[model samples]
Structures are given as structure tokens and as C-alpha cells.
Target: MLAFYPRFIRTFDDLPGQLSLLIHAWNGCNMRCYGCHNADELIAKPPKDHLSGAQVVERLSGYDAMFDAVLFSGGEF
Candidate 1:
């Protein structure tokens, strides 16, 4: 499976001191729904470069003081 995703999706929140992080697990989906932009690489397993749980926590930890909260989004969370 391929591992690729956008850096972040814009948020609509108007609150101050807020930051959003869009993390892609890169775990391909089983569904074959039409019009899926990521359909080409859909599979049962995630790519070898997919970040582990600990790595994810560590990645988010860096933004602890800068962001109020982090949002996890992907084909599934």
C-alpha cells in the first residue's frame, strides 16, 4: 500500500490559540466505494512506513504547548 496524505485540512474554528493536526495512519481501507481519491492503494494492510502508536504520541507531543488539541483523521481513526 502507498503512504501519502495531505499535511492538514483547514479548520473552521474561530477560537484563539488553536491548532489542528491531520495525521494519516496510512492504513488502507477495505471499501471500494466509487470516487475514492485513494482507491488505487486500498488494501488490508498499512504500508511499512506507517507511524506506530508511540511515534504518533511523540509527534503530537511536540505541539503540546502550541496547540489546544489535536485531531486524528484518516480513512478511519
Candidate 2:
């Protein structure tokens, strides 16, 4: 199984028609839900560890030319 990261790029094997990248927005969430699938990792993240929105945008821009679409993934974008 794939270990999840707060933010990273992944290419899908099942998506249709175009080459896409999946980017997990961050390592945390604030809304606590019952039986949360990813709450453990989300809540435990240090606020200082992830990139800012501007940083994410700058990084992905380089790959936008190569990918058909960029999917921003995570609890909240």
C-alpha cells in the first residue's frame, strides 16, 4: 500500500484520457469527524512543516506544461 504524505505528486493509473498529477495539499485538518479516515496524521502535523499556497503554486507551475491537470488533494485546499 502507498504511505500518504501531506504533500506530494502522484500519477494515476486509473484516471481517464489525460495525464494528471495528484497533490495532497497539506498534512492536517481542523474538523474532527468520527471514524475519520485520515485524522490521525492530519491533527498531528506541525504547522511549520508544509509549504504555503504560493509555494505550491510556484512548484506546480513547472509541471503544468507536462500534465493535463493538477488535482489539489487534502482535507481542505
Highest TM-score: give the candidate number. 2
lDDT (10s digit) by residue, model 2, range 1-77:
11234466556653688787876545454456678654555556544466666676677776667887777555654
What candidate 2 gets wrong by more than 4 Å, as runs, is 1-7, 30-48
Error of 2 at 17 (Å): 3.3
lDDT, each prediction: 0.52, 0.59
Q: Pull out the clashing pairs in model 2.
A: none
lDDT of 2: 0.59
**Alpha-carbon TM-score of each model against the true structure:** 0.49, 0.55
Please give the TM-score that candidate 2 achieves against the real structure. Answer: 0.55
Q: How close is candidate 1 to the true structure, as a TM-score?
A: 0.49
Worst 10 residues of 1 by lDDT: 1-10
